[model samples]
Structures are given as structure tokens and as C-alpha cells.
Target: MGNLKSVALLLLFTFFVLHLPFVESDWFINYHIHVTNDLPLLNSPPNQPNLFLHCKSKKKDLGERPMVKGQDYTWDTKVNFWRTTLFFCRASWVGRKTIRFDAFVADRDEMTCRHYHNSCMWSVREKGIYFSKNNATWGNMYPW
Candidate 1:
């Protein structure tokens, strides 16, 4: 009986060790959005829109934590903007898609969030700009 117990313990330990890597295989990706409020130009003419961003996406490293404004401030942008792009990856779409975005700031305001939010902001980590209006309308540019 003692020998049987020892064998079972050893087997369990081996099983856990072997599956450790597989259990944690899910890697994380971060995304950021750089937006220039341009509140100053809010009153500017429509042609010369005041609202502008440094670029599209701006990626950063935040270990494995969710992206947050005050917590995660280390930005990665080639062009400067008003609010720094920030984000982190998380499981989404019922585990189908690995969604990544700024923890604090969203792509668009509350009203437009559901339909066209992701497109409005850029993903820093993914290095891509998102636009709800037309996903294909954005220009190809490195995340700054």
C-alpha cells in the first residue's frame, strides 16, 4: 500500500510539471492610442480640424498587467500627442480573440463606444490605428 501511494504521488508531480508550460502558454499583447485633444482648436475651422493625434498606434511593455492611465505611463510613440497611448492584452470574444486596448482611455466616447470605438483609437502594442467609421480608411503608419 505504501509503495502504491508513493507511485501515485510521483505520477501527480510529474503530470503537473509537464503541463506547467502549456497552462501558461497564453502570451499577452498590449495596444495604445495617442490622441491630441486639440481642445484649443475645437473652435477652429472644419477643414483644419484641431483634433489630431501623433500617429496611430503606440505600443509599450507593462509586464502582464492590464493597461491603465496612471499606473502604466511608459509610452512608446515616435510622435508626441496630448494623451499618451496605453493598453494591455486580455482574453476576449468568449476566448476567441485576444483583445488589447488602453486600460483607462477607450477608442471613442461612451456614446460611440459599442459600434465604432476601437477604430477611433490606435493600438500601441498592436502598432495599428483603429477607426469605427471604416476600418480600411486608416493610413499605414508605425505606432508612435
Candidate 2:
């Protein structure tokens, strides 16, 4: 009886030790991409001027999402195209038009890591790089 009890305890300990790895494996690193901009609709060739881009991410973890945050923002410009320049969050104030966008990511414990920083940029065409025209107020046009 004593021998059997010891064997059972050993097996349980082994099983628990193995389970620890699976739990710790949750420690993973991922990234997110977001874009925002507003371009006044110029009455010309493209009536409803909209921007689009064929984006590819170097990191498999980072993908594309509409607008991470969609409550407090507006579209000042009519035509715009944005892509992932880096991972940005809605915490830092870059300029007037460009505000920080928050990204909600999870870690090992499922704790939310919100508001990474301005890590994204506009596509080469959108020109979200200048940081000059980024002084417009947020209108109703968010994450389009």
C-alpha cells in the first residue's frame, strides 16, 4: 500500500511539472498595424477620391485591422490611404491631425497591453510621413 501511494504521488508530480511548460508557453510577442489620415475631397478626376494600398507585413504577428479605436475621431480629409508604418497607440500626441491610436494586445497572463505607441505609418503614397499636414482635427472619419 505504501509503495502504491508513492507511485501515485510521483505520477501526479510529473504531470504537474509537464503542465507548467504549456502554461508558460503563453509568453509570446506580437505586433499590430493601424493608419489614419484625411485628405480634402478635391472636385476633379476622382469624384469620390478614396485611397487604397497593397500592404504586406514583415512580421507574421502584425496584421491589419480597420480602426482599433472608433469612438473619438472624425475624418477631416475626404480621400486618404494608410498602411502600417509601425505599431501605434492612442497615447502620444504627434500633432494636431495625428493622435495616438491604442492597440489592445494580450500577454502570457492575458493581461491587456494597450496603447503601444506611434509605430505605424501611412503607405508610401498616403504620405503619412511628412508629419506636417498632421494638424487637422479629428472629424467623423476614423479608420476608413
TM-score for all predictions?
0.19, 0.25
Which candidate number maximizes lDDT?
Answer: 1
Candidate 1 local lDDT, 13-115, one digit each (tens): 9976876543343111122323222122223444442221222234544343232211222233221233343343331221122433443343233223223
lDDT of 2 by residue, 1-144 (tens): 999999999998997687654344322323223343234323323333233222232333333222321212221111111222222333221122333332322221122211233122232112232221123322232232
- What is the Å distance of residue 95 in model 1 from its true position? 44
Q: What TM-score, to 2 decimals, does candidate 2 have? A: 0.25
Model 1 scores a C-alpha lDDT of 0.34
> Would you list the C-alpha lDDT of every candidate in the order shown?
0.34, 0.30
Q: After superposition, how far is residue 82 of candidate 2 from its true place, in Å?
A: 27
